[model samples]
Target: MLYITGTPIGNLDDMSYRAVSTLAAVDEILCEDTRTTRKLTNHFEITTPLRSYHDFNKETATEEIIEELKAGKSFALVTDAGMPVISDPGFELVSRLQDESLDYTVIPAASAFTMALVASGIPSYEFTYFGFLPKSNQKRQEKLTEILHHRKTAVIYESPHRMKQLLKDLVKFDPKRLVSISREITKKFEQHERKTANELLHMMDKEIPLKGEFVVIIEGYEEETVNFTGTAKDHVSELVNEGMRPKDAIKLVSELRGMKKQHVYDEFHK
Candidate 1:
């Protein structure tokens, strides 16, 4: 049996009893970083042997680990922090495990994005978790555009260094949109600042510190009430007639009416 466990994101006290005992019982522990997991194991007095299993060695490690599992070795998979397979190295292994008919289960624990969202006070009834944005400018802009047009609250993870750039992009796309910036979650310097995109942009260096991991919660798009008397296609055509590009017009109509861009595009083009 493979146990996919959750480790504390920050404060060590958040480690659950089951997680500790399971780690202690496992024959071997597969970790992204042995040095980091070492601290946790040492604190709990768990002597389970740890083997490196990260993105670099994932392909080869998966095959070896699967054979060990076939030989009845019970191993526990863990990331440096939080749950495994969540923007971490476990999805491929899990998929391979399923293919091999191997049994595995997850041990639930805190997630930074979920914690940030709850602390954000944003509308959480509906949400979309976008683990991390693309690094390239063009790809990132396309992703930001998708988020801007989405009707559901969006959650994203970002590195400390890129936080400022992300805020600037948000401000450029939609300054008035409300956003919650959470940093160092569950840590000593943890903070959650709620403000408009533009406000946060201006306060980036002045108020918000550029340190630790960040979870950005963007409020869902609110439909704008426009006094337009026409069908959806007609609305798209009307915007295009007013000097807007066809694609831009479609995007605008979709956001304003809370409809999918493809639906609007199809109607307009037909």
Candidate 2:
């Protein structure tokens, strides 16, 4: 059986007893970084041999691990922090294991996004977790636009260096949109600051220090009443007249009026 384990994001005390036992008992431990995992193992007195299984070597490591599992050897997969296969390595291995009817169980522990959501005091009843944005500027902006369209809370994991740039992009879209920034989670200097994009941009370096990994929780897009004199079909026609594609116009009308896309399409065609 393979074990999918979760490690403490920062605080070692957050490690679960089951996770410790699983790591200790496994024939071998596969980790993103042996050095990072060593700290945890040393603290818990778990001497399971750690093998590198990161993004760089996941393909080959996965095949080798699968063979070992097939040979009746148990292994535990862990990331440097938090849960495995969540914006981290181990997903492909798990999928392959499923195909081969290999058994695996999760040893759940703390996650930065969940911790940030609770700390942010945002409505967590409905939310989306976007682990990390694209590194390229164009792709990142495109993703930001998608996030702007979502009406539920959105959570994003960002590094300290990019935090300011992210806030600047948010300010460009919706200056007054409420957002919560949580950093250094489970650590002594942890912080959760709630403010608007514009406000937060200004507060950077002044109130919020860029030191550790950041989890940004953005409030849902608040739909404002858009006054228009015509029906949905007419709205689509106007946008179409303005050189928008029929399909694009239909989508725009549906989004703007909070109506179903099919309903708008039918009205536009009628």
Candidate 3:
């Protein structure tokens, strides 16, 4: 049997009893970083040996792990922090285990996103978890635009180094949008700041620390009821006549009409 366990995101005390016992019982533990996992194991006095299984060695490690599983060796998979397969490794191995008809169980524990979301005080009725934005500036902007248009709350992970840039992009896309920035969750110096995108940009260097992993929770776009009677093209043309650029006009009309920008652009251009 394979155990997919969740480790603490920051606070070591968050580790579950079942998770600790499972790790102790397993013949071997697969870890994203053996050195990191070793600290946890040492703290709990767990003697289970750990083997490296990260993105760099995933392909080769999966084959070897599967063979061991075939030979009736039980193993527990864990990431450096939080749940395995959640913005972390373990998906590929889980898929292979399923294909081979191997049994596996998840030992549930704290997840950073969930902690951040609940702490954010944002509407939790419905939300979309966007693990992390693309590294490229263009791709990141496109994703921010897409998130801006999302009707439900959105959650995203980002590193400290890029936090300021992300805040700037958010301000550029929609300055008034509400956001919650959380960092060092469950740690002694953990912090959460709720503010508008524009406010966050101003607070970036002055107030917010750029020192730890961050979770950004953005409030959803609230649609307004605009009583424009003209067709989409007519609305676009009117905006363009009112000094708005054609592309900007199309975007505004699309948002007002709850239609795709590309569709509005095509209609206006044609």
Candidate 4:
């Protein structure tokens, strides 16, 4: 039985008893970094042997792990932090395991995504979890564009260095979009801010330490009100004039204005 164990994003006390037991009991533990896993193993006093399994050697690792699984070995998979197979190397192994009909379940623990969600105070009843934006500028722009059309709240992970650049691009595209920046979750300096991308940039200048890992929660693209401040509103009004009802026009206008439907309708017609 393979176990996908979630480790603390921070704060060792966040580790669950089940996670410790799973780490202790597994025949072999796979990790992205042996040194980091050693810290966790040492902390928990888990004696399971460790094997390195990172993205570069994922394919080779999967082959070895599969061989072990086939031989009736029970192993635990963990990453440096958070859950494995989630924006991490354990995905290939999990896919291979599924293909080979290997039995596995999660020993879930703390995740930065959920920590950010809770800190942001956003509704999680309906949300889209986007692990990370593309690293390339073009692909990242494409992803942001796709997300701009999404209506549900989105949870996204990002590196500290690129986060500032990401906010810049986000503001360039749409400055009014609500975004939440969470950093150093579950740690002494843990902080979360609910603001627009532009606001986040300014906030970072004033408040954010900008030194830790980050998870960015973006409010999904909602149609704006007619009170919008830019050319985007003109595009929506143009759509309304093209045989579209005021209601539909308001919907389009709201896509950029972040205003009420009636206000958009009134402004569209007025």
Candidate 5:
């Protein structure tokens, strides 16, 4: 059996009894960081031997670990924080396990993305998780463009140092886009701020301590409604000047361009 157990993101108390038992019962534990896992095991008095299996060694180490499992030695997999295979390792193992008909199950624990989303006060009914944006300016801007248009909330992980730069980029594109910045997941200083991109950037400059990992949840675009009273003519003329019929212009502008038709009509009339 291959147990994919989750470790605490920050608060040690988040470790569940099942998680402790699974690690203790397994013949060996494959971890991203042996030292980090060692401390967790020591706290719970789990005696399972540790083996390093991380991003660098995942391809080769996974095969060796699988052979051990097939040999009747149960094993547990864990990362430094949260769940494995979630912006982390275990994808390769999961795919291979499914192909070979292996036994595996997940023991879930605290997740930074979900926690940050929930804490954000952002609508959680539907959301897209983009683990992290590309470091390049071109790729990052491309991602930001889609993220701005995306309807549901977007969750992304960013490093401490890059967070400020990321926020600056966001503000440059859309100052009014709301966002939630969360850090230190379950620790004493665990904090989250809900505000627009500009607001969040200012808050970070003022409040955040400049350390710890960050999870950013950005709100989707929602255009504000404008009263169609008299602006309809001007709006219509504006679209028509841009080469569109009064009706199609209003419809197109309102439906796609985010300008109300009545407002367009009022504008044209004027």
Candidate 6:
């Protein structure tokens, strides 16, 4: 059995008693960084042995861990912060464990994304977690476009250095769009700011300092009803005239009217 543990994101007090005990009791503690995990173990006096299990060595480490589990060894998997396997290593291990009929369970705790969502004041009925955007400009822009069109709230993880660029891109895509930025979660200087992309961009350095990891919550796109009293081709044509690509327009029309994409494509191009 493997214990998928959740560690404190910032505050050490957030570490649960169960997590500490499990870490101490486990045959081995698998962590992304032994040094980082050592601090936590030292704090709680958890003397269980620590092993390196991160992205670089996950493929090889996973198989070895599987064999140990088969031999009746129980391990606890943790990351530098937050829950293991969430935008972190351990996913492959968990998936492999499932495949091999090995047992595992999660020890829930604080999550920056969910905390940011509730604090954002945006409608949380439905939302999407887009962990981190691509580092490049073109790919990031394409992803930003997709997020801009998403009808539900979107959550994103970003670094301090790229915070400005993210806000800039958001302003370019939709200046008036509501966005919430949360940083230093569970720490002394934790801050949550809610404003439009343009407003936030203007106040970047002055008010919102670039520091700590950031969780960006963007308000969902509210699509307007398209009342086109015309043929399917005409509907597609009108969208195309408004600068939407023909292929994209066809897809939008199909989605709005609940028709198949190929059916709409045939009508529009016939």
Best by TM-score, which number?
Answer: 6
Model 1, residue 168: C-alpha shift (Å): 1.3
Candidates by lDDT, descending order: 1, 6, 2, 3, 5, 4
lDDT of 1 by residue, 138-199 (tens): 66766776676677999999998998888877776578889999999999999999999888
lDDT of every model, 2 decimals: 0.89, 0.87, 0.87, 0.80, 0.81, 0.88
Can you write out model 5's per-residue Cα lDDT over 155-209, one digit (the tens) per residue?
9999888888888877865777888999988999989888888877777756987
lDDT of 2 by residue, 1-270 (tens): 999999999999899889989999999999988999999999999989999999999998889888989999999989999988989988899899999999999999888999999999889999999999988876676577667657789999999899999998788768888899999998999999998899999999889998899999999876562245679888877655544567876886798788999999998888
lDDT of 3 by residue, 1-270 (tens): 899999999999999999999999999999988889999999999999999999999999999999999999999999999999998888999999999998999999889999999999999999999999988765666566667667799999999899888888777657888999999999999999999989988888678878889999999876551245668999877655544557766876787688999999888878
For candidate 1, report its TM-score: 0.85
Question: Please, what is the TM-score per model?
Answer: 0.85, 0.86, 0.86, 0.80, 0.81, 0.88
Candidate 6, 105-224: lDDT as tens digits: 999888889998999998899999999998876667657766766778999999999999889878866788999999999999999999999999998878988999999999987655
Off by over 4 Å in 5: 223-270
The predicted structure with the larger lDDT, 3 or 4, is 3
Candidate 2 clashes between residue pairs 3 or more apart in a chain or in different chains: none
Better of 1 and 2 by TM-score: 2
* RMSD, one per candidate, in order: 4.1, 4.0, 4.5, 7.1, 7.7, 3.4
The alpha-carbon lDDT assigned to residue 78 of candidate 2 equals 91
Q: How well does candidate 1 score on lDDT at residue 244?
A: 53
